[model samples]
Target: MVQKRISEAKEGKAEEPNLLQKILSMTVQERKDFWDKQFMKCIKCYGCIDVCPVKREEPEELSLSKWIEKAKVPPPYPAFHLLRAYQVWDTCILCGECEETCPAGIPLKTLQDITQFFSPEDVFELVPGLDKEIKDVILRFVDSKRTQFRRVTYGL
Candidate 1:
């Protein structure tokens, strides 16, 4: 499989990598720097969450604010955007609203894509009943932040 992919890349038949693949392929420091640059541009408007269809109130037992308090614009390492993505990891609908609503142009939807869409199969091994394929859809991410995804074969 590895050799096939290498040969295909050399032959120009390899599929173009998506945002999730491209971002995940980055080195640790590169990923951190990418996120830092993206988050640093945030004005802390919370517009991403405001426009999210999956936005839900944080549960007390699983609260995240204690560990990551609200701060000024260009907030700390784990900004609200990151925390919000963590909170919705299991329930994200991937409608692409958050990315569209972000004023700073952060690619927040890619986080959702990376976590649930293209993630490794064992990621949900501990959750006996969780079927990751059930979340898969005909979604694609372009170079721009206009990636749109709708649940293709399931009723919401």
Candidate 2:
């Protein structure tokens, strides 16, 4: 069933609209409505963030509550939340720790895995072996951003 869902998602044939696009397209009301439903299970235990290996790389100010708060404030651009969502692709190891720890029983790992499919860099990371061509591609992708930003931003 998981494989089937993944295959359908890859084919853009999932019954629900693409979550990445939907998140990118959300209005204020829509964003709030959507997150409220998803977060209803959240107990504010901070288990997800706590277990996330990449939390150290995330901005100190970015928190689940902050994301929910952002959802309530505006439309057209969910810049902070969207950026944070994208960052999940860079940090997640598909470890499933967050899912297991979630007191609310949210499928956090599944959400993260599905979200990764929408990130080209994350897709590249899933390639089977490291070869010269793959190395070149990864370096080029990394180098492009190095030139684009001044500070040291290691993760995507």
Candidate 3:
């Protein structure tokens, strides 16, 4: 599925979209409605963030995992998951820890997968917890704000 998504992304197809691409094209209301179902199960325990091995253990409140608030009993819709998706998308190695740690049985791995579908093929090797150096470089490049960003590599 990942390979197919990458292939379709590279091709820039506009015809009938697959399930992964469908998520990207969903309207604001449609997206909110869709995620509402999934997030309703979340208890805001932050277990998904805690179990994420790809994230840096930073004490700073704005750091990746710390961006999620501790006070919200129920997480704020899909925002938590969306933020987490960007945090780990390029580096996730398909580990199921986040989903496993979720007491609510939310499919966190699947959510991450959907987000990673658009990650740059060069940056996202799906290599597991062993690519910290490469992940850091990618994050640094993004934070530097060198260009209009989208993971898809066009003629830029």
Candidate 4:
């Protein structure tokens, strides 16, 4: 199943890379080691965050990985980094500015692309479950911020 999906993606038949193949291509240990090395090179310069279009709109109070770490333990429902990662699917222009600006040379563009493949639903599915409370909370937050923005402005 995974191999077929990867082949399909490579052939452009699939919209994105197979999530399972992306995960299986690297072992858990490999991922840990890769991230460990990348994290070591991070200077916390916020360049990546600044370049991230999603972060521009959302403006995370913390760095990307820090947000992920925090979301993993307590909240678990609305993982900001996970949402940001998937947002790359539509928002990423592939201009590669984030990768170029990274002091760590962590291949931010590739990572974002692959992660987006795995979780495209996160972009459209603001509320994964039918939990009305969670849905209402997200709707209120998003609508409040977006409702005032002009659909057309400055004759773009």
Candidate number with greatest TM-score? 1
Error of 1 at 21 (Å): 1.5
TM-score-based ranking: 1, 3, 4, 2
Candidate 2 structure quality by residue, lDDT tens digits, 1-156: 545665666677887744544543445556556554555555556576677777666543333343344334331222222333444544567887877987777556645654454443432233212234433443454455457643324321
Query: Candidate 1: worst 10 consecutive residues by lDDT?
Result: 136-145
Per-candidate RMSD vs. true structure?
10.6, 11.8, 9.8, 9.3
Q: What is the C-alpha lDDT profile of model 4 across 64-145, one tens digit per residue?
A: 4534444232323334433444334335566667779887685666556544443333322322322444334334544443
Summarize candidate 3's per-residue lDDT along 6-108 as a digit string, tens digits: 5576578545665445655555556556666768788887788887888764423225344446777566545566556655654677798998999988767
Best by lDDT: 3
Candidate 1 positional error at 54, Å? 1.8
Give candidate 4's error at residue 95 in angstroms.
2.4
Compose the digit string of candidate 1's lDDT tens values, residues 1-156. 544555565567889755554554555666767777877798777787788787788644234454445665675544355456645655688898988988889888775665554332322221112222322211111111123353312211
Sorted by lDDT (best first), the order is 3, 1, 2, 4
TM-score of 3: 0.53
- Residue 135: error of model 2 in Å? 31
When summed lDDT is taken over every stretch of 10 residues in candidate 4, the lowest stretch is: 121-130
Candidate 1 segments exceeding 4 Å error: 1-12, 61-65, 117-156
Instruction: Say which prediction, candidate 2 or candidate 4, comes out ahead on lDDT.
Output: 2
In candidate 2, stretches whose alpha carbon ends up further than 4 angstroms from where it belongs are 1-37, 60-85, 119-156
lDDT of each: 0.54, 0.49, 0.57, 0.47
Enumerate residue pairs that collide in model 2. none
- Assess the local accuracy of residue 2 in candidate 1 as a C-alpha lDDT between 0 and 100: 41
